[model samples]
Target chain A: MAISVDYVVRETATNLRRNLLMTTAAILTVAVSLSLVGAALLLRQGVTRATLQWQGGVELSIFLNPDIAATQRDAIKTQLDAMPEVRRVAYVDQEAAYAEFKQMFANSPDMVESVSAKDLPPSFRVVPRQPELTEIVGQRFNKREGVKEVVYAEDMVETLINFTDFLQNVIFAVAGVLLLSAALLILNTIRMAIFARRREVAVMKLVGATNWFIRVPFMLEGMVQGLVGAAASFLMLVVSRGLIASALEGNHLIEQFVVSSADVMGTGLFILAMGALVGGAGSALAVSRFLDV
Target chain B: MTATRPAPTERDHWRRQLLLTLVAVAGGIVSLRLMALSVARERDVYLVIMADGSRVRSASYLVTLWPAAVALAAAFGVFASLVVHTYRVARFTFRSDIEPSPTGELP
Candidate 1:
């Protein structure tokens, strides 16, 4: 028997309307889980932006004794410049160091007044050819003659990054659990639909209705649930975009701590796609099982 | 040795399983793309030059890492989903003898 599109549409509608509570539960679960996913994506971007600024602040700093001989400073500079691991080396003379000190403590006039050009140490700001080799290379000059101490300025950023990684993992875990719940909810809704319409389904099968005929409407139901949940999540993200930007007002000079409109929309698109695929897949599986055509 | 032909019910089960597997693979690919985009952001290098001649650079692995790892992960996701779906289909008790019932819609 040729099943009309109208019949299928009506059946799907009836199935959805009949199971209002179950459908709502499924949708809300999907929305919550997807919202977490959206939040996680935004968090990652915020961390990336903030880290970029932190990373821009310093690489490896080698401070010299404030009273080090000019010859000693030059020797250290020359040695650093020649190393194959070193990408570039720049010397920070006393006057330049003083200027930076003033800028860094610009808010505190008393602090700036207490230190002078002579008190600040001349240093070499070294960029490594390979980032991974930074610690090992910095470790080389720990107790050397002219060097007072080598500072891995990026350590502060590294700690924050590790924290961000841990946080993202936690968010993903929560989202994973919610996603599983959403899947089970979808499965239950479909099963209930099958149970509710078993009489009609049996009559349709007896009248030679193919499995595809019985299955299409149910698969459509699953897709709709996934999509609506995803759409709800997409809207949530859209509404909440730039939350971090506002929260972190007037931050680092790099100003890269932004979650652009594109990021939200892109993540929204992903949630939508996932909703459709997972939504249909679950119902398809459930429908096929009970179809028995 | 004479091989026995598979029953029609078994063939129908295979058809349904194939459809579900296709859906799983599609879901896997989409998820993988999102993950790759996230990992690839690490390639951007942020640079800062102070009032002094000293320069600071971030994300040093900009040139030599991450992309390969992301690609490997994508490959793994694709293969894993297919294998997992196959396992589920083989082991699950989705028999055709169950009662005729059909409901449509996700969620």
Candidate 2:
């Protein structure tokens, strides 16, 4: 028997309205799940951006002994600069190093009085081809004759990266579980709805309704629910982002870690598409089990 | 043929079993998260560097809300599964009560 497309659409609309609460629950579940996933992505992006910025400013400092001869210092500088990883090397003399220190602590007369040109360590300020190689370059320079100490900002960089990585892993794990819960909730909701309408479905089957005719309406309803959920989740994300920005505006740490608008929009769209796919598939599976027309 | 009704004792027993399971699961999850957090707090390292370059070290770790979220998800999953299982059992019992007996017998 032939089924009318108009009838299917009307039936789907009626069912959607009749089970408004269930539909709403399904939509909200999807929205919350997607929002979590979206937030995780945004956080990962922020971490990547901050890491890049920090990497760009990384430098290696190679300190020298005051007794090192000028000719020996020149030779060491030449050797350091010749390395493939070395981008540029500037030799800082005792007087120049002292002057720079004095200028930095100009406001503190006590600090300036305690240190003189002779007391200040003259060194070679080394820039690397890659920020990550700063530590390696510093260690190599320290091992060379006439080199007293090496400071490559290794601890700070490692701490930041490890912290971000740990946070990102936690976010991913949480998001994964939330998404699984949403999927299970959606499947169960649809199953219950189908069970409630079993008699109506039996009557339709007796009337010669085809499987596709019955399934299309439920799929459409699921798609509508998913799209609405996505829209709500996106709005929530935008509001939360705004609130966080305002709260952290004056905070030095977070000022450099703001999520960009473009990333938010892109993530929102991706989540919306994902929600639709999951919802539609979940509903189809539920309907297929009981409505085997 | 008349349908057979479930005994009151059987119904009561099922409900009690479900309730116990829910409580046990919830308590177990709470205890697990608490243990993890307590262990983590003890090993945490906190360092304070003064303006004069002097450093002080104490116990601290960058604890955030992420762990709580994971614990919540696990709890939710346990609750959801319990609910689904209870519903299925109830539905089967209800269906059995309504269906005519194949032997044409009543109890």
Candidate 3:
């Protein structure tokens, strides 16, 4: 019932070499599927992060008129703070507003240079208990004497939420389809490999070799194919990330949307594990058809 | 030869075929369920209370789609595994009698 390491390795190598075309095809398909899945996962993470950032940024900005006195601004802030619907209120003076604007448009030096500190208005940023209830806060100061305009980023948040949800659905559906096809391809390739070695398998069985002893080599072969494919795809993903980062150079806003390394590595590991499972299970099932206990 | 392997009986053949048939039927049911879920309309929404006591409306698409997808995947996996195992076992048993023994004792 005991098998040697060299024997197992030699058998696995022989099987792979004997059916080189099938092995290559299976590897390539697995690589393609896993890479797509990895990309989709990264994209999903990026969108989720962006959506959360957008949600956290959801607030109402009540811009004050240039002529509004400091005392009036303080009074408005106090009123906003007194409301139960308002979770918190922060007063941003004209100077701070100018600074934020400059930072946001740092990529566009010409635009940032053209905007003067006096051009930006001081405002109160209100965070509501519920983001969807931001309108209640917006209307509170809409027609006030010193208030110039009341605006909430709710529209942007809503649009981003819808887009993110759509993207998530597309990612999941497409990934699912690709992974399933990859599984089937692996299954077919294993079946072919087992068919070619049927006689050898039967001989082993007749010699009283354990079923596991007969099956382990085939499983190892599949695992090697899967690992090679996963590694290839993961390399491609890393290269693509570099390409994207270079493409987005100089655009700070878009640069912020880059997928994190943690996400990339996590997704890579997940795909690698999945590849192994697909390969091992596929070969096991294929060989099991010809084996009996 | 000192030993003779037991020959497969007619009942064993029928039983193996029946098992494979059942696997196929189960696969069909899984496929049907997947299709139904895919075409299912987006409804069955409910309100969820957040940690802050705020209520949020959740659509079926948001809440149920992932689980449905997972269920479909599980079904596909189980069906596929069962089909392959049964088919492999049936092939092995059917061919065992015709294939020559390793010891070259058939003659």
Candidate 4:
């Protein structure tokens, strides 16, 4: 029998309306999972931005002994400059060190006033080729001659690395679970919807209806559900992003975290594609099993 | 009198057999490919600049997400099978003549 596009569309709409509750459940599940995935993507971008800034701030300060002669300081600098771990080194004499200390501790006027150029120790500020190699640079110079101390935020760097790693694993685990749940829910919803219309399906098969004729409407129904779910999730993601940005406003630490609109849209498109696949594929599999002709 | 069933034509039988064989072969290939991917070593490498400014390769052989990769392969295989089977069945249904027997049995 020849089938009309209008008939298929009307049938799809009727199926969705008849199984409204299951359809709504499927859509909500998809929306929830997709939103979570979107949030995870955004969080990853934020962490990446923070890490880039952290890389720029990564430096090891090698403080010179107050009594160290110019020759000794030059020798230390030469040694450091030749090391494979060191990217570049800047020498800060007592006067420059004192100026930097004053600028750094400007908030504490009493401390700045009490310290003089003669009291501040000269130092070499060392940048590493890679941010992660800062530890190696510190270790190499930590006990060297003419060096009073090596200053680097080892604990802070370790904490940031641990935090990023934890976040990555957590996001993957949670998103995986949620996506699985969403796909299963879609499968179940389609199965139930087809089950309700089994009598109609049987009649169609008896009357020599082609398999595609009987399948297209159901597949379309599932696709519509997925599309709706994707749209809802996209809206939720945008609103949540706005809320998060507002909440984090004026926070100096997060002020630099910004994701381009294109990136956000790309993630949104991916979520939508996943939704469509889960819904359409889920329904197709369901009909093939339950309404086999 | 006993009712004798008509023998299915050789040509029709052969056509059906050929389609089934094709599907089976495709399924086998997919399974073999999946196995190979699963058994593959979980190693990935990318270029990075070392502290001395020379480019070097870093490997994440142990840290790769093998489970996810296998899962992705499995999903793709299943989807491909589904599409191929559905298309074949739909085409067969469209072309073949299906008639119900007196007891409502279809052939």
Candidate 5:
């Protein structure tokens, strides 16, 4: 007899009800797994935003000597600006630089009251087309005869990148362990289901039921369990994402870190698929030995 | 002389216990995964750095919990199947003396 889809569906439903606790366990497994995956994605997004913000702030500072000639200063600016890596170079004349210093030291008026514009060195605030090119521009300016010092914010960028990398590795490692544990757990649950139905299986064998016929229903039951678990996980991820985004928005530093709606939905679907596959595979494997012997 | 046979009830009881154990393990794994994910979120910056230095910020967008969840679930299903099948074979063979009719011989 050809097995109807309705028949398979009914059998799966009945099995689910009969093994309610196991079914629940399977679903929970899927939910937890999916949640971890979702959280990891969100964490990555936050790091990306922070890095981009930092990179945007990178600039080359060229400090000029106190004795540099006006004509030489202008020439240096023109040379630096001509480089393809150089996006823009604004010269901060002695007067302007001195005003900035005074403003910066405004909290202590006495400290800057005697200082004059000539005492403050002229400099160029050089913006680069790319953050990575900051080093190149800084090095070039450092070799110039009239430049006193060259500073590029390379240390800050490197530190941020290293820190982010360490975090990703840790997350991935934890995710791996969770996945291993989940598999083992599902394995045990399906084993129990098979054990409970051993008599039924023996009877089917007695009646000459094919191995495939006996295994299909249990496999279907597992798939259903996984699907349910994935659904639950998806819902939880959505709620958690909203809560996290709200909390992050309150912090100005992390306000840009938000998990979009589309991401949540996409992740949910992926989790559901995973749950079903795991459940089905677990059930099938658990029952295989019994069928063979 | 009559041969004393082992009871089917004994096998059934043992099988039930095994299934319960499996369910407990699966539940524990699920709980652990949830906890891990929560912890991971708090350390997002570090995770990005590890994924790719230049693209650390973008790494979060690429990472997803779905693959791990699905992988775990699939692994569990296979484990369950293996455990159940193994138990059945062992139980049947061990108690064959109680069942006068061989499994294949029964109608």
Candidate 6:
């Protein structure tokens, strides 16, 4: 007899109910694993966003000789403005520099009072067109007349980028490992479901029933588990999004760590798709062994 | 007597299908690795460069993160397609049957 749609659906439902506890365990494992994957993804996106908009950027400070002539300093400024690598330039006079020193040393009133405006050197603050070009831009005036020194925060920038890379690697690796475990759990669940009814399968084999007729129901059971798990995971993400954002946003430095709704939705779709794969493949492998074909 | 052995052609069919399915699984795994790389390089990172204690304009690479999304999605699609193919193959799978049953239906 030909297998009908209703037969497949009914059989699948029966199998799911027959092993209720196993089904629940598999789905819960899938949900938890997918949730971790989603959280890691959202965090990566948030951190990347915050770092791009961070206050620290490519800049250089060109300190001029205190006894430099006015014409020489003007010439240096003119040359800086003409360079393609320089985005903008600001001249910090001796008074502004002295004020900065006082602010920096405010905790030590004696130090603040000791350095007068005349003791502070004037400097040119330069922003580079690109972060990688910061060093190149600073090198230009290193030997130029009226320039005493060129300074840029090179180490700090490299450290931040490297840190983010390390973080992304660690998080994604954990997610990947968890996903594998979830897939294995799904496989075991399907195998047990099929094994419990191996006798029925042998009977069907004795008759004219095709393997597809017997296998469809089991596969569908797996798919159902996967889809349900995905739904639960998605719901969890939606419910906890506010708490996650609030916790992270409590810090002013990383207030931009909030992911957009679109990010959440996208990650949810990914989890759903992943769940389906693990389910479908898991059932196929489990049934294939018992079928001995 | 032992159950009848299947034709060589049937064995070859099963082997070919299994091999192809394995290839699909490999593709899925490779896509996952690519996704990790995509996430790492997905966006342009900005450095907080300072000149005389003052912040400067941020640099950007403008790299897109869409590839990460695409890679992950492709992995799922590839695995799902292979799984469905495997299920369809089950319809024509070869099987060995018993000549004697514990219920004494056959002697």
Docking class of 6: incorrect
Candidate 4, position B34, lDDT: 36
> Chain A only: TM-score of every candidate?
0.69, 0.74, 0.70, 0.70, 0.74, 0.77
Local distance difference test, each candidate: 0.63, 0.64, 0.66, 0.63, 0.62, 0.66
How would you encode candidate 1's per-residue C-alpha lDDT over A1-293 as one tens digit per residue? 67788988898788789888767866765676567656656656655665555565356988887778888887787788779988888888889977976775666688668667876667788888766778877988888887777777576345345544554454354344445544654565566567666667767877888988888898888888889999998998887665645754764322354578888888899889878877788888777655663
Residue-level lDDT of model 5, residues B10-94, one tens digit each, is: 3453354345435434543443343244324433422111101121231232253333344345445534654454455445434
- Runs of candidate 1 with Cα error greater than 4 angstroms are A1-7, A17-22, A63-72, A75-122, A126-151, A242-258, B1-107
Q: Candidate 3 at residue A219, lDDT? A: 94
Whole-structure CA lDDT of model 3: 0.66
Between candidates 2 and 5, name the one with more favorable TM-score.
Answer: 2
Tell me the interface RMSD of every candidate, in Å: 12.8, 11.2, 13.7, 15.9, 12.9, 12.5
What TM value does chain B of candidate 3 have?
0.41
lDDT string for model 2 (A146-251, tens) is 7777766444345445644554454455455445545656665665677677667667776788887778888888877777888888887788778877987886
- Of 4 and 5, the candidate ahead on TM-score is 5
- Model 1, position A120, has a per-residue lDDT of 65
What RMSD does model 5 have? 12.0
Docking class for model 2 is incorrect
- Give the winner by lDDT: 2 or 3: 3
User: Candidate 4 on B1-107: residue-level lDDT in tens?
Assistant: 99999744423433443343344334323433332232232212332222222322232323333433443444345444434443443344334343333333344
Minimum summed lDDT over a 10-residue window in model 5 chain A is located at A171-180
TM-score of chain A as modeled in candidate 5 = 0.74
- Tens-digit lDDT string for candidate 5 (A115-210): 667766667889999887888778877778887777565553454355445544544444444444455556657766777777777787777877
Candidate 1 lDDT (Cα, 0 to 1)? 0.63
Q: What DockQ does candidate 6 have relative to the true complex? A: 0.03
* Candidate order by decreasing DockQ: 2, 5, 1, 6, 3, 4
Q: How many residue pairs clash in each candidate?
A: 10, 1, 1, 0, 35, 3
Error of 1 at B53 (Å): 25
On residues A1-293, what C-alpha lDDT tens digit does candidate 4 reach at each position? 78899999999988888888888877876776577666656655665665566556568777778788888888888888888878888998888866766665666688668667777667788888887888888887788877887777443344334544544454454445445545655665676677666767778888899888998998888888887888888888777667757876885544445555666788789888888887898788778764554
- Measure candidate 6: CA RMSD: 13.4
Model 1, B1-107: lDDT tens digits are 99999644433434443343344334433433443343345434443333333544444443423443443454345345544544443344343344443442122
Superposed on the true interface residues, model 1 gives a C-alpha RMSD in angstroms of: 12.8
